[model samples]
Target: MAPLNSHSYHKVLALLAVIVSLVVTTTHASTITRRLETIPYLDYTGIEAAAREAISDTLKRRGVDESDLIARELLGPRQLSVTVPSCKKVSKRKEWRDLRYNEKKDWIRAVKCLQTKGDYGISPISDTLYDAFTQVHQTNWTDFHGNAFFLPWHRWFVWVHAEAMEHECGYSGPHPYWDYTLDYKNPTASPIFSTDPEVGFGTHGNIPLREIGQGGYKVDNGAFANLKVNLPIPHFLTRNFSAWKDWDPERHWGTALGGSFSPEQVKIALKAETFWELEAAIDGLNLTTFNDPPVVPSPDTPAPAGIIPLAGIHNGPHFFNMGDWNGPFWLLGTDWFPAGVVAPNDPMFWPHHTNVDRTFWRWQQRPGKQWEFNGLKGANRTDDPALPTDLLPFYGLGPDVPVALTLKTENWPMCYTY
Candidate 1:
């Protein structure tokens, strides 16, 4: 061996560094692949059975025949006279992982594009077209969640977002959904959090909370890492994938609280008979378990004592993705997704909510359940009927559509399916 010159030594060191980087990256990718392989794909057949059983049991208990219910034509006539788009025209939304690498990149580009456009003039807090949607959601948080408006209102909201991206950013891809159930065993390992700068939503923020004096870890990689926003003050995209044990001590904290949105839990929610029951089951308002005799309470029944309300499918992803601080100050110290009001600040909000809408759509597809929309209405959360005449507020992003028009996904304005 000859004595090495300075230049030769530096070149050797650089080559060694590149080799080490490749090894680490390859190891990480292989670990994720193995973890995902352990989880089984979603069982659609079993899910459908559970949903039907729920509706059947409800009908049996009520002493009402399904035929009579359908004949009564409870789901009212379509409000809009526009021609319903054919199957060929309808866009199909797919799970985030299902999108090809390039498709994912295109969707991400559109999102970034929307963030650069001017605000819709809806709120002073808004600084971009993207911020405008967050503003509206924050302003109408009360009306949107914990009511009959929860499902349909969000259905419309997601549609408006996709439409905005299409018209303004020229995005031609179907809106993607994050089916948390697929990653329910270990959310952190989910491919949706891929660190790939081109396709991933970015990995969990590693920034220490003390440095920022905030709960969330600022996202520092992937497509939205450079993303900025102006709602509740401007900042970079942040996420903290903390478990929910601090928030709900009764439940064991799986990674990012994956158990809350597990396939089994979703199956239980699917068994809900009415819109309200389904909403409660999915949103974690009440009804913890259905195993022992499977008692599902009507909206009128007060939540049973001693049963801790778990953050169901809808909220599980929010809490898990954004994370929360422990103890009495939890509310004061939380991330964007957990904030509930301005959750749209994070691009992950779209796919999470899209999966939510997909779940609602699945429940609606059950026989004789398409027009079976009924739930408690108003800010008081009273037991009023969720009339089709009820209006959904969209601010300036889109038209304020009636609740009726939002029931069927195939209808005009909402010409898409999961």
Candidate 2:
């Protein structure tokens, strides 16, 4: 080989750097995929078999097979055909910890920007557009929870929040989700709660409030520490981290509050057969009374009647992070996340719910399960079918869209993926 001139030598060096960069990027991506796939999901062979039998029995009673029911139910009122949008491009959402530091900072900036923008004059309690989102949720709280709308409605809600952050605040970072399973062992110490001034959402509340009990502390560090929220009366942001407690073998599986959202729980939720079962599992509404061990409160805190021990994978993070543990009596007037209605007040709500939506998306990807939706409808939780034509009103954040449009994330308007 002839000796190369300086120009050729520099070109060769640049080529080598590009190849190394590509290799590292590919390796890192693979590692993330592997870590997610290898999570040890819980084995519930007996429960799963029972679930399948129950589904078969329900189909028999309805006098139709599963395929025929799904096909007929999906074909909603004719008007819905006019509303669905065409997909232009699909975007990938990443786990919060997977995002680069700058991406995290950008997301935080957009969220803060949203806090300053004025609302569309819809909600009396809303001081800004951000508060309006919370108001919309709070107003429809009863309708959205413990029913068919839980998963689909939240999928749309989180997407709307992301769209608002992008259009109104000029945010361009990839949508991120908090994979609670990663922090199920020790959530307070997770990077999601970092005190880092630039990227952290902030740690658990530090200033104690007597009204909210032991877990109620005003956030005192990180990017959103100074953030103030309006709705049900204005107040600075707060969080009551579920205090780490000893594991009771007879009562629960994991030690800390995070254990409620462990990988095993999520895996079991993903294994649900029907949309009803999936929603119930993800929302911590264990249908089978015998499978999950009851959560026994400390002797000092008497367990109330009808108190279900499991918080489900979806509710676990919200309850634990917001320090909304049940005691002898449930407290009132606090804006803690476990209240469910005012959960969006906390910045953590976005990523937390994003992870939830991600779980729903994962379950949807199962063979022959993408369009599997069924459950009670309306605040009454009656037997009315949750049709695709059912409207998901945005309260001026976006168009009132059909539930069908929100089903497949890769479809138009909701063109995004995990």
Model 1: clashing residue pairs? Answer: none
For residues 1-418, what per-residue lDDT tens digits would candidate 1 score against the true structure? 1222334333433443343333222222210111111112222223222222332333333344452232112212222332333334788999998888889999999988887877646667766778887787876466667667899899988887887788778888878999988988888788888888889888656764433223667788877775676666676666676634455455464566777788877787777877778887777665333223323222223332321144678767777665221111223444533343667878888999899999999988888677666666643433445544344665545444446567777744457887
Q: Work out the TM-score per prediction.
A: 0.71, 0.71
Error of 1 at 98 (Å): 1.4
- At residue 25, candidate 1 shows an lDDT of 25
Q: Which stretches of candidate 1 lie over 4 Å from their true place?
A: 1-88, 209-214, 243-245, 248-253, 287-308, 323-340, 378-383
Clash number for candidate 2: 2
Q: Against the correct fold, how does model 1 do in TM-score?
A: 0.71
- In candidate 2, stretches whose alpha carbon ends up further than 4 angstroms from where it belongs are 1-85, 211-215, 243-253, 288-308, 323-340, 378-383
Q: Please provide, for model 2 over 251-313, each residue's C-alpha lDDT reduced to its tens digit, 9 standing for 90 to 100.
A: 353545565678877887788778877877776554443222223323222211222244667
The C-alpha local distance difference test score for the whole of candidate 2 amounts to 0.60
